[model samples]
Target: MPIKSIKKARKLIREKRKCVNASQWFCQISLAFFLAAILTNQLAYAFFDIAFLGELSTALQQAKVVWNVLMYFIPGLLMILAATALVMAGINGVVAFCYKQQLASLKRGEG
Candidate 1:
């Protein structure tokens, strides 16, 4: 019985670690996407300042238009994705904390 209890505690500890790792990864992904979105937004504004409206070739002007749309649109999409990852990370963090508390109680033989 003691061996089985020890095994169960170890399993819980492993699960807790996995949850922590997953939460960390999700947070990192969220931060990266957020930074990328900010960068793209800044780039879009920088390109918007180009003063070659009347001097550029038709193809170049068309390319600029496409670039503007993509830059604007991509930031909004990425922000949404970042929010989702952040939410997932929060959930995982909560679960990991809960597991930690459970493990503590189990260790005290009061679980």
Candidate 2:
């Protein structure tokens, strides 16, 4: 993947977004959101635990209580994570389909 020469680097720069296509980028972003949402739930609890305490189990329980009360907007954070994941999956599927369509069009020289 490394540039073999300055010419190749210049060619890449000139290409800009001519590589992959926009729908592919959208699919990548949706996949990233899916991962981020999963991490966010775990990270919320871990953040509080890291900020406090000497005992692991006890510290995690305290963190959970604080997180639940503070993040009550979601009622249960797991529910939020699940909803976000579902949305992400739906988006990813749409974008992936669009990307495939774009590729097909490119092959047909419709652009």
Clashing pairs in 1: none
**lDDT of all the models against the reference?**
0.88, 0.55
Give the per-residue lDDT digits (tens) of candidate 1, residues 1-111: 388778888988999999999999999999999999999898777767764346778888888889877877999999998999999999999999998998888888886
Query: Whole-model lDDT, candidate 2?
Result: 0.55
TM-score of each: 0.81, 0.34
Question: Once superposed on the true structure, which residue ranges of model 2 sit more than 4 Å away at CA?
Answer: 1-75
Candidate 2, residue 96: lDDT:
53
- Residue 86, candidate 1: Cα error in Å is 0.8
Badly placed stretches (over 4 Å) of model 1 are 51-69
| TM-score between model 2 and native | 0.34
